[model samples]
Each structure stands twice: as C-alpha cells, then as structure tokens.
Target: MNLDELAKKQSGSIPGYELVDYYEAAFPVYRVIVIVAILTEQNLPVVQEYILKMLDCGLNNIGDIGGFLGLSNEIIEDSLVPLTQQELVLSYLEGNSLKFSITEKGKDVMESLKVKKPTITSLPIVFDALTGSLEPHKTGLAKAKEVKDLEIPIIKPYLNKPMLEDIEFNDVRKLIKRMQKENTDIAPPPGELLDIIEVEKAWLEYKRLKVFVFYSAKEDDVMVQVFERTQRAPEYETRLLRMEREGIRVLRTVKKQSVRNGLLVENLSFNNEDLKSNEESIQEAEERVKILTKNLAEAEEEKTDQTSIHTIKRQLEEARRQLEIFQKGDRVLSTYEHRPILEQALKNAQNRVLIISPWIERGGMDDDLLALIRAALTRKVEIHIGYGISDERSSNDTYPVKKLKEYLSKSFGKYLKLHKLGNTHEKVLVCDEKFAVVTSFNWLSFKGDPNRGFRRETGLYTQNPVTIKNIIEDTLKRFNEASC
Candidate 1:
C-alpha cells in the first residue's frame, strides 16, 4: 500500500492519537568486529583419509605409505600421530621398524570421511550494532559517515560506545546460539560458540527506515512506529522506547527538526488548477447539453421516431448531471505532476523567480539545479530566496548555498537576493510572474529519498496572472519582513 493509506491504517489502531506525520529517519546501528573461537563440525583432511586407506590396504610402514602418497616420511609421521591419538590407527614395532594398521574405529571414520567432524577454530565475528546480536562475518554493512542522504533529524543509538566496549564473551556466545536456532543458513548449525578472543573493532552506522509519528495533544505524548519492508519493526520500536527512557527523546527531536524544516505539514489543499479544470469540464458539459437539446427539439418538431426523441432527452439529462457533479466535486493537483512543473518553471522563467523554503541544503540544490539557477542569473533574471524555519539556523552543510552565493556575489550579485526568515513553513516558487507553485515539498532542502521510498507531496500549479502576482507579492513581503 501507499504511505498515506499505510498511515491511515496505523492511525486507526491507536486509541486516541492521530497520525500527525511520517518521514524517512535514521536508525542508529553499530558494526562490530570481534575475534572469537567456535567449536564446529568440519571435514577430515584428505591426507588423513588417504593414510587410513593405505593402512587398511596393508601398506603399514611410513616409508611405503609416503611413497604411495608421493609425500615425505616426515609428513606421513605427522599425519600418523593425530590418527593414533584418536584410536583410529594402531602402531606397533616389528622387525626394527614402526608399522601401522587401520583399526575398526579408523574404518568407521573412513566410511564417513567426507562428512564434517568436530573441530575448534578461530575467526572474526561481526555483530549487529543495534541489538548486540551476532551477524554473519561477511554481511555487507555501510559506515555511518558513508550514508549520504540522511542529512538531518537523526535517531540516536540507544547502544552507545561504552556499552559496546562492555559486551562480554558470554553475551556474544548467547547471541550466536540464538541466531543459530533462528536461521541455520545464516548462523549455521551443529556449532557451539567457544571463547571470545578479543573485541576487534566497532563503528557507528545507520539503518534507514520509514517512521510514522502519531501524537495526542490531550495526553501530550507521541507514538513512533518504525517500518521495514512495509511491516512494523518491533525491535526498532523497543530501541526507540529505551532511548526515550534514557532521556534521548529522539521522537521529539525528530518532530521538532522536521517541523522547523517544513518537512512535516498538513494534507494538500485545492489548487487553482483544480478550479480551472472544473470550469473546463462544466463548459464541455454545457456544450453537449446544448447540442442534445437542439437535437431533441428538431426530433419533436419533425415528428421523428419516439425512440430518437427519447435518446436525445437521455443524452441532455446525462450532460446536465455531469455538469452538476463537475461543479460541486473537490479538485486537487495530481501528486506526480509537481516536480516537472517546478522544473519547467525554473527552466523557462525570464524576468524573476521567487522561492520560499524552510531550509536550504544540498539535496535540493544539485548540480543540474545550480546550472539552471546560474543560467537564469546570466540572463539577468532576479532570483529571490527566503528560508530558515527555526530561529536557530540549520547545522546542515551550507556549501551548496555558500557556493551559489559566492558565484552570484562575484558576478551576478545584483540579480540575487537571499533572506533568512524568522520562521515560516511556506514552500512556494513563483517564476517570471507567469506561474507559481505552493506545495508541501521543501523546494530548497528536499530532493527525494530513494531509501525512504516515495513521499506523498503535492502542490498547486497555477498560471493565473492575478494568482501569480498575488503569490509573488506575498512571498516578497515575507522576505522583506525577515532579516536579509
């Protein structure tokens, strides 16, 4: 299901709370490497199997066995000691030479030589950073710094560095056993975790997940539900709760950041395009009704077949009904149409462009978008930007904004005006007084998050001259009201 439907379904489950907002947020995870020893089943070496076969075949002397196997006497002697210790081979002194023979135990072992036998070995084990659970050593994990898209509003890890350091051998051993029981293919079977040789290394990482945030003003409480692969992730829910108990308050922090940055907003509203489309539909229906009415009058005057007159009346009635529905139904902008509309406005604007977004970050101001802005500036189009939703400016990377400002200041500064507002959630773009867009999308801070899937962002696109003029004027008024 779509995110909106999913949110609605989740909201119904809550007693008195409503789904206030949903956003893509980061879940803290750690990648830990620990050196450990495990007792596991392994296959017997080929050389040992070959020696048993030779001894069973009555090739007893070490020199003769080595010659048959194309190995030296020293290698054969080394292979014999383990076999003899295991009671799989019998050694005796005869005629001034040591001789060997395969015992019943050795024959039995030979029958299943290809099967895995019990052995203890040392290897590196990687643990799931969040749950302190065991993960396969070769599992691919991303480093926290390497995550590029999670720029703001992070959910802090409940499991901290000190806690990672204090992870004991017994803890890892239990985790391994638990994993083994859960998934044999991932953590294999018939194995016992031995001693932890050392805690090798640990580093922070993030697991990206969709979060639905619900709040009840009456109770002054917030509920956060994390989703992975479209299902509720209880482990993450527990982690978030523990984080709250520890006074981290990640949900509150995320909500505050999202609100300040205009990432959270109410549902989309009717746009001017909706009214225009409805008007067009009503006009088309009126034309149809007129044509059908003329046909009905002609059919009756001409004394045509009763069936023809009846058909004309039916068509006219249907047209009138459709006209009524078009006049009364609510209208909305299609969710898919906003991005291209904004891009086209950016590309085609001639005289001026005004943008108001709560935050300015690199995600929205990509190289292609920068090129568009530069081209517009080169053409001497005035570009006015008003931003900053929180009283405290965002700590996100300002390199994109700074770079654009420097370029404009050096060459086309006259065409640029940058304003930091006290606080606003208005996401608008007006271009060349030709078109304007008011949206829930953060035009300067949000591009799109692929990991989070699609967000339900919608906007009104209007080419109405009066509406555009009013939007541009109001946007500039806010810009002028705020500090430059």
Candidate 2:
C-alpha cells in the first residue's frame, strides 16, 4: 500500500485528528566500518596440511616431502618458513642435508584445524541509522546524489556528524547474537564479542520514507508519524521530534517555506475582484432601498386605499430585507467559524444551497452534518454538491456517497444533485442569494473537529448580493460541466 492508504490506517488511532496531507521524506542512513571480533573457523592451506602430514610420517627431507606432494623442493622451503616461525615445524641439519619435522604443537594445530575452531578476526559491520543498532554491511543504500534529485525534504539527524567512537562492543555483541539466533547466512558463527578495535565513519546515505503530519489545535501540538516499508517507524519519529526540540527546523519548516509565492498572488487577485464586485452591488442595493422607502412614505401621505397601503408596506419590507442581505459587510472567518456558518446556512436556507468541495468523507459529513442535509432535503431545499479532485471517483470514499444516494435518492433525488467534478480546489458554500463562503476550508472533508490540532484555514463569509450570485452561478456551472 502507498502512503495514502497507510495514512488512512493511522487516522483511526489519532482520536481527534484528520489526515490533511502526507509527503515523501528521508532519514539518514550511515555506512559505518566497525572492526569487530567474531568466533569463526580458520582452515589450514592444502599445501601446508600436506607438508605437516608428510613430516609426521617421517619424511624429514624437503625433497622427499615435495616429491610426494607433487611440488618442487624450492616451494616446500618457502612454505616451511611460516610453519617454522610459528613453532609448528623444526629445521635441522642431518648429515649435511636440511630436514623438517612437525613439533608437538604442530600436531595439535593440525588436529584443531580439522574441526571448527574459534578465531579472533576483525570484520566491518553497519550501524542502523534509525535504531542505532548494529547490522551486517548492506549495499544499494540511497546516496546523497539520489536523495538530492528527489523533490522531498530530508530529515537530518540531530547528531549530524557521526564518529566511529560511537560504536560499542556490547552493541556489536548483541547484534551478532541476534543474527545468529535468526540463522542469518551472513552472520558469523556463534561466539563471544571481542573488543571493538576500530570504527571508520563512512559517508552519509538516505532512505526515503513517508511522513504524515497531524495537527492538534486543542493541544497546540504537532504529531508526526513516519513509515518505512509500509510500517510505522516510531523511532524515526522520535528522532525528528528531538531534532526539532534541539533548535533544528525539520519537515514543518521546510513545508512552510516551500509554498509558491506566485500562487498566493493569483489567489489575492481573484479575491480582489470579488471584493470590488461586492462593493458595487452594495451601493446599488442601498439606492434601491432608499427609493422604496421614499415611495412607501409618499403613499402613506396620499392616504391611498387600505389594500394599496398594505401592498406598499410589504414591498418596502422586501426592499429593506434585500438591502440588509447586501449591507452586512463580508467577514474573514477562521477555522472555528466555518462550521457554525455552514450549519446555519444549511438550517436557514429557504430556496437552495450549493456546496463545492473536493472530497467527501465521514470526518466532515458526520452524523450531525448528515442530519442537517436530511432536514434540508425534507424541506424541499434544492441542494447541489460538487466533489472529486481526480478523474476517477474511486480515489475518494465511495461508501459514504453510495449510502447517501441509496438513502435519499428515492425521496429527495430530484432536489439533491451530487456532481463528481474531474478536479477542483474550490471550497464554497452558497445559500440562495442570502450569503456565501469561499475559503480554503474543505467543507465536506473536514468538519472542524475541536479535538483536532490547529490548521491555518480561512474563508471569506460574504452577504454581498453580487458575490453570492457569482459563486452560486460558478458552482452550478461546474456541476453542469462535470455532468457532461
């Protein structure tokens, strides 16, 4: 499974958090050369074994031994130096002829070499970057060049510069025992760990892993979960947290700085246009209200028929209501304000409500929100919804949408329209011509869970007639486009 699937699995455990986003990140993997002593067998060379056996059989002369072993006398003399120095062989002059003999030590050595023998030998071992555990040397680790080419962020270890002195004998011993128990082919035979003679710190490598960042607004905390090979790596998460606490900026910092400035400018330009249109609409609606009020006053002064006066009063009230709808200045809503505004709109809508959000999941469309929808549908309020950010609808949770269709289609299908758009980033909610909200908040995918950590989401809540009309028209256009 991919990071998305892994994030979903992780979501259930995070009580009040939602999976906002995930990204590719890396952990430092270092290649360390550790000189370790292990218990292993050392075998005698074939030629040496033959010479020793020959000497034991009373072949004292080099010529006789070499002849039997199918080697020249010169070769026999060269091989004899080590044996002699090791005290396994003795050289003597017998009747002016050089001869060789196997010592008692040589007999013991020969016998011991035949069976598995424990020997102290230095070997290079690798240290795990995440757990700081010892492991066999591995190849195919991602190099700095490969990691640089990737667009992901890299989480540098708190101890950036690792030294060989950090490796200890006990760590190596435990690793060897574990490997032996597991019957790993690469592990040395079971034996005691000798002193760690030397450690050579090699170049740092990187292992790409997935990271899911969760925000808890209530606690004002950020929780990070890391994954390697589709499994949670809590040790790595701890490392990241430690780095951050040590004044080292990590994933969150990188993500913040990576936002493109050009996109911000484009969004600002669009918002400015909406603001200008709202101002013009407000001015015109104010003028219309003034004219209606003046007409109602003139009719009262003329003492018109009771029916005509009553009609004028009703018209004047409608004009004032329309003016009020446009005069309530637009507002900037925070993450906390989105829910109540959306719910209020749903509850108070008289004619229609239009919502456009990219995703629909249980997190946003909980039982409460679903009930509100049901009430709106029961009132015969026209509800149009547009969702989906990918070409395939399967990318989203289909079960919720399916259930909605199955439950409401029979009775309210005519009034409820669910349009799966090919792709959209727009988060909008419009209630008839009364008010509308346009923001970064995902209205259908996030329900402003109080237990969730803070996410910096803001929306423009507007009662301006022109802005509301534009949003509603644009939303319905998208719905029509998607249906095509």
Candidate 3:
C-alpha cells in the first residue's frame, strides 16, 4: 500500500485497522528506498525505477530530465495537481536544455525520506519493504508435510479444503519475541522497557495472527504438500504407533480445571468495574478452571455478575452440553517448547494484567511510558495488578507501593490492586486470564533504581500448558526475562 493511504488507515480508525495495515504503517520509509534502488539499478520497467534512481544517485536510468539521466521536465509538470508534496524528488533545469543536479534541499528531502520511510506506511510492510525475509507460507507448508505417506483415496475432492483461512494463528509467543528483538535498544530505565512492552501490546491484536493457516487442498497463497479427503484405515503397525503417541501425549499433563472446580483463584479480574473498553473480552470463563477441563459448556445465563463467579457452591450442576475432545486429559505442558513460555504468558496477558511481588513500590512505568498504557486502553487494553507488600515498615509506610499503584490507576486508567502482605514472599504478575507474569522483582522495584537496588528480581512465564504454543511460551517467558 502507498504511504498516504496507510497513514489514513492509522489515523482514521483505532479499532478497525487490520494487521496488514498496522505492519505496513510501522514499517520505516527508508526501507522503501531499497525497493526503489533495486528497480532503478536493474534498469527495470516500472515508475518506481525513476524514483529510486533519482534518490540513490542524481542521475536516472530512464525518464531523462535534461542531458543527464534524471527526472524529466515532464514529471515535475505533473506535480501541479493535488499530489502530496511532503517528500518528493523534483528535477528541473537551472538554464535552458542544461545539466540536472539535485539541490541541497532536495538532498535533505532524500535524507528525511530515508529516515522516516515507513512512518506513513503499514507495520506489516516493514518486514517485506525493509527486512526482506517474511515467508509466512513456509510454516504452513511444513504443517501439511508433517504427516507422511498416508492418504485417503475414497473421500470426495470437494471435502479436502484446508482448515485455516487467515494468517497468524494462536502463536502469540513467536510474534512477541519478534517485537522484543526489534526493540533491542539498551534500557535507559525500567520505563523504556515498559514503553516497548506497551507498544507491543498496543499493536498486539494487529499481530494476534501472523502464522498463516491454509487448507491442504489448494497450494496457492500458502504452500502445502498434499491435501485429500478420505477415512481409510491404516495398517495395524501404524495404528499401534499412533496409539503409542497418544500414550505419550497423556504423559504430558497440565491441570485444566472446569468451572465447577473453584480451586482456581484469579488474583486479578474485572469483578464488574466501571473501567473502559479493552481489545479483548475482560471476563474469563472462570478465575481457576479444573484440571483436565475440556470444552465444557457455558451457562445459558449470561456471565454478568462477579460474586457469581467463585461464589457458586458447586460446578454448573450440569453443563448444558460438553464440547468434543478425544480424551479428557489434564492440561499438558511440553518439554520441547521450553523457550516460549514467557512470551506466551506476556502475549496472553491482556484483559487484566496482574503483577504480584513481596516488595512493591512506586514509579514503575515513567510518564512517557505510562502514556502508552493510556493509548493501549484507548485501544481497549487493560493493565491490572496486585502486589503483596506492606507499607508499615518502609521509611513511610505505604508510600512507595501506594504511589506506584496510584500512578497505574491514574495515568493508565487501569485499576492496580495493592495487597500488603504481613509475610515475606516471592514475586508474580498474571496477565489477562490465560497467562501469568511471575517475576522476582520486589515490591520496591516498582520504581526503584535498576543498577544497585535491594531488589532480588527474577521471574518466568508459565502456560497452563497444553498446546505446543502454550508449552513453548511458558518456558520462554521465564527464560527471556532471566536473560534480561
């Protein structure tokens, strides 16, 4: 997409900006120079060729301006219309039929354009327009090829369509990791870290899905090895191997509770507050779900009340109906995806973000940093927390922690629950409903000095761990943070 069009997309709508729009806009403008340069250098046939050639060198390969290869007098004449003049390459002769040279101001134009290339572009386009290595289809192709030789011959051709139509599946950890890598600037203070984190969040929904999903049948936009529809039985040995795999899958257990099981106690929740909107739904099916929880049915009654959540003496006496699952197994954590644990936790940390620690204090996220939270809230992202730190003994009891919590509520329009613990303990931060931010940052470090502080800071990401994505995320969440 073009610059103006992408900018309009970003400024015009807050909620409706598509993922492509976001990526395109976040992309830098200088990156476009690469595309322009390639075309111009190659003497390719395209209008961009002229634009790139002029920008790269004063001379142009095509569309003569004067005696030298530069923008022709004809192109400048076209600019008289309602064309945007924010950043342009103008080629005009000082004398009649004379030589062409770029003015200092025009050179400045090139520099400025190079610097702010994608300010007006989409975030998604940055990868393509600049980096040149975004192959979303590769993963999809890999998925299709995962299963070998087995094929169904009896099924109809019409039934072999792929399952996912959109790109960016539920792999939140992978993309979040990408963002973290993009923001590798050294930390000026904790505020810088918080700001980058918030930016990732502000645009989280935009990248909620980057991993594309394609049907097995068509080998078009996405790559796929084979797709067929049939239910033919495999050999006895094959069936035995499949059974063994299922047996191993059972060994990887996680506690997935049912709504009936009140064992789960959510540290943070909407609890029916007057808070404004957020990108995703705020209410969770249950604060703590039962282990081995499956597609349990939701109550026909709307989940409008808070006390009604855990207040129930028993599980839904009888769920309207059960969702389908091959086995009613406990939540399973994966050993292979140990790295993605933290990322998954952070990615899933929406709706209500909770940070728990024994020593809590104020000024966690600075002014510029806090503003990003408001921006996120304007986009409907909620940041909530509960920290365990008593203000009774500090120089001024409740001074630091109180100040920290207050700033969170005031600046970000988020409610941060402050819990003073009369006992010593560990640190933790739970995000949204599905993820938790368990860390070692003390309550005082909320805004304490990062260099020399009493804070024994550490933490990791955890998944209720069932899906491979979740398994990987929970591990990485902690690993990445520890590395930092």
**Count of backbone clashes for each model?**
0, 5, 67
Candidate order by decreasing lDDT = 2, 1, 3
Residues 1-484, candidate 2: write the lDDT tens digits: 7544565466545877644445567677777765666555457777888889899999999889988988998899888987898788999998998888899989987887542334555455665565676666666568877765442466665454446567766777877787778876666656777566666556677777887767665776777888876888898788777776776766532121111121211322235566567657766776777787888788889987889888878877887787666646674554445667788888999989998877786545656777898889889899888887775543244445765676455677677888877677677888889888777777876522223333456567767676666666667767877862
TM-score of 3: 0.22
Q: Candidate 1's residue-wise lDDT over 1-484, tens digit each?
A: 6444565457546888755556556666666665566766556689999999999898999999999999999999999888898788999999998999999988988988843334444333454445655444543444556445435446666566523356676767776776677764546345676666565666676666677766666897767788974889877777776766776666533222122123222322345576677757866886788788888888999999998888888888899999767744433333334445556667888888888877777645656677787888888888888887674665134766776678656577788888877577777888786667777677766533333422445455556666666666667777777878
Q: Which window of 10 residues has the lowest lDDT sum in candidate 3?
A: 32-41
Best model per lDDT: 2
**How do the residues 220-319 of candidate 3 rate in per-residue lDDT, one tens digit apiece?**
1211111111111123213223433554210111121122111122322222222221111111222223311332323224553555544342343222
RMSD of 2: 20.8
lDDT of each: 0.67, 0.68, 0.29
Clashing pairs in 2: 215-453, 216-453, 217-452, 217-453, 217-454
TM-score of each: 0.57, 0.45, 0.22
